[model samples]
Target: MSDPGGRGDTFCGINPEALQGTINSLKRDAGRLRGSATGFKTRFDQLGIDTLPLTKLLHVASWADDQLPMLRRRHHLAVLIDKGADPVLHYPNCPDMIMVDDADVSADPPKVSDVPDGSDPKLNADWWGALTPGMRAELTFLYPDRIGALDGLPSTVRDEANRTALSKEKGQLNAKLNKLRKDLAATKAIPPSNVDDVGGAIGGDPAYELQNKIDAVQSKLSGIAAVEQGLAKGDHGGFPHAYLLGFDTHKLGHAIVSFGDPDTADDTVTYVPGLGSKLAGAEGDISRASALWQSSNQQAPNKHVASIYWLGYDAPQLAANSHGADVASESDANAGAPLLRRFTQGLTAARAVSSPVHTVVLGHSYGSLVTGRAAVHGKGKLADDLIFVGSPGVGVDRASDLHVDPSHVWAGANSHDPVPDLPGPDPFEDLGGNASSFGTNPASTAFGGHVFQADQDPSNSFSSVDLDAHSSYWDSHSESLDNLAKITVGDYGDVTEAPQIPSDVPTSPTLVGPGVL
Candidate 1:
């Protein structure tokens, strides 16, 4: 069956005829795929890197190769093979990954006076207890994409790993691109022996395959360059330096970078961005985060503040055929919730109890759903304060249902923003899955949270404030930004609360732009 919408392509891509053909091919190539997997394991063994997971993953990927694009299948194999083949591979010795136990920390020689009891023992302060300086430095040489994914590592270590990984990727891509360009130049420079040769050259065009290769190489290079430029544009100078928390240059891309050290700050805010958020446009989110950091510091002059622009989750995309409506879903949020939750726990655990860091988790647009899922379902304490601005709907019915205290929860939405009006369908009620299933709007009185002022430009009425208003919550000099700043520094009393929407007023949008941000 042909799918009118792109949803079928995005998820399983399961068509009966195509599925049958794919299954048949997989069965035919089973022996070859196993042989390839064995070769991968042998190579890993020769390189002295862990092979079990890498080999098994490759074997599994081979079975699905018939269903995916050839390039994607190749990439899948490359990544699986790269687990052990990467020059910077580090296989942790322990059979199972474990956080630094309290016993381990106490037994080690005193490292720092401010080391908090039961804090994430993997933090920089306690780095020595987990790994020696040599081993730590060695990790810098490994592939950051792999290292950054591992939990229970120090934030700074993760940062260094990611930076190194990016540098390595860029360097490799540049070298390949340069070689391709040289080959193209050589092919173009070749002189035709005769005039007929030039006219008939189309039959055996020397540059055809080379040109295709160059285009493919250039495309890959451009993607990495885009991400780098995004990071550069958002770079800030001074005390609160930027730290790359996570990065991956695969499909759709993802990144988690911070404007300051969450592990050491007295106050930290991890801002989760919403719809249309990808690594390509990460700079905009990072810039907003930097502005929030500045605003928070200015709001609370004495306190140290940090802000993290978290783009770890694969957000829903407004595909070519998709309408602006029905973009919110539970799957992406559910997939990313654990990552968000663990990041928060690591931040909290890395701090000194003597000066416990007060953390605020802020979500904008679809990001609110991600934050909600992580906080409600994730293990341990995720954050001290939770703030949702311009949310579609969090995946819960009430503030009480969220693990955090109802008082600590705060919600804000611009009067003109259409997202807040999305009363998503209940998945249980709608078996067809066409309707919105996200829970009650947290900003609504029925949901129960401290509603804060996120008023748009008064000149722009509810009808006038378009989808852009959804993203303007952090606009400088706006009441919304001020309240957000105050909240970031834990000045809850200073927040200018907005009244709940009256029952009679229309909640859904009367006007929406061509796209949803």
Candidate 2:
């Protein structure tokens, strides 16, 4: 019998080869359009016509630029169709896919409830593994936000879903911001009335309220922009492709961005930031992860290294009048512990290789406490190695208390960073009182963890401990970052050891409570 679908085309009636050729031609046209737009803009600039009123009328180039994303989407769909692949699985944006209202509802893909419990990593992995590509793609397209946050799914799948979620979030936030700005302007246009005389219908300070809403929306947008910038870094630098594993804009916000694919990488490092960490400050955290990835890759060029910045937990903030659950207490760490544990377990459950991948978990300042609690969450070890830098404490007096072997646990504390010197719950006790506010100082001799060199720039003339030293642990070309990178890549012997805090150091003078010092 003759093939009715044409040669090399199975599912679709179109020939794959011909469609690919058309796609190539479309790509060429897109390139030319881009070039033409650039040329037009350049000529306008050269003629000083860009600043004239006529420039506003010359929007052809802008229109062309706006069409690029749609063309790119078309290209993506064409390529997928040529390969007979599932569109929802490979497509970058879910909303861009065409939806048919007449489509059969009974043919919908499996929902998250199909699994026993989506939060359980092993169960999630098993459920995902059992799904067909088409089903998986459909499910991902329908529930990008939920699927993206699920831990056991493949990193690439999560990245695609999360990118769609991010795009939708950015668009929504932009719209809200514009509306809020308009409202603020309208409110401002109203003459200022006496605060006491303003009617209850108008409420107190309408303009101020609108301005607050605008500020909040702008903050979220700024965070989204930061994430986009982080993703873009992968295109130019020698760095591997960046992945948005998870994200949320609620409250302080949350994000899990990876520098490389953790499932396939030989080595993976997950770094958790400390106090005051939020989505708006994600650029700095992402940069730190990128820096660590660069340093570790340099050490082991042949091995694939993935670095992840995990701000999944609500890190404590230093605020006046804040008593419990502040940076000084273990409330945040205790709450974040189980989540961190589940994340690490998900990493293990989602691995594609039978051979184990070396995984390291590093926490800075308050994050160390969270990491520590996660390590000791259950019977087994959470990570192959644990690194605590600028930590107040890890909620334990001894490294042996953590599930990992004492030898595999490491600590780094700069002399100028006073966080490591803060008093623990007990001032006089040998082991229990070593840490500042959490528990045992992991860098202390009593803790029995290896201490590594982590000094601030010697060029600085400051003689006192300060916040600058606490934040400089990830500085490029610094000893602290180099040591961290070495530990991350399993190059332990090369790491320079630093002196541990003496067990007998007077805890009385260091009894100052934490409030950001």
Identify the leading candidate in terms of lDDT. Answer: 2
Return the lDDT, model 1, position 2.
21
Candidate 1 off by > 4 Å: 1-128, 178-239, 324-326, 426-437, 459-465, 508-517
For model 1, how does the per-residue alpha-carbon lDDT over 114-186 read when each residue is reduced to its tens digit?
2233234245335534643323333344345555554445567667778777778778878987998788788
Candidate 1 lDDT for residue 42: 88
Candidate RMSDs in Å, in order, are 19.9, 13.5
Per-residue accuracy of model 2 over 1-517 as CA lDDT, tens digit each: 1123242432322233444555566556656766665667678788876544334434543564555554443343334433322333222233233321112222433566754455788888888788655456556766778888888888888888899899999999999988887776666444446244654224457776786788798889888888888788874679998989889898888999999889888999999998888888899989999999999998889998999999899888766665433556777888999889888888888887777699999999889989999898876998999999988888887899998899999999887677777755565653444656677778778789899998866775235656667788998889889999999989999999987667666222342334442
| Per-model TM-score versus the true fold | 0.66, 0.77
Clashing pairs in 2: 422-436, 423-436, 435-441
lDDT values, one for every candidate: 0.67, 0.76
Model 2 CA lDDT for position 350: 83
Q: After superposition, how far is residue 82 of candidate 1 from its true place, in Å?
A: 29
Where is model 2 more than 4 Å wrong at Cα? 1-106, 109-117, 188-203, 320-325, 430-433, 460-462, 506-517
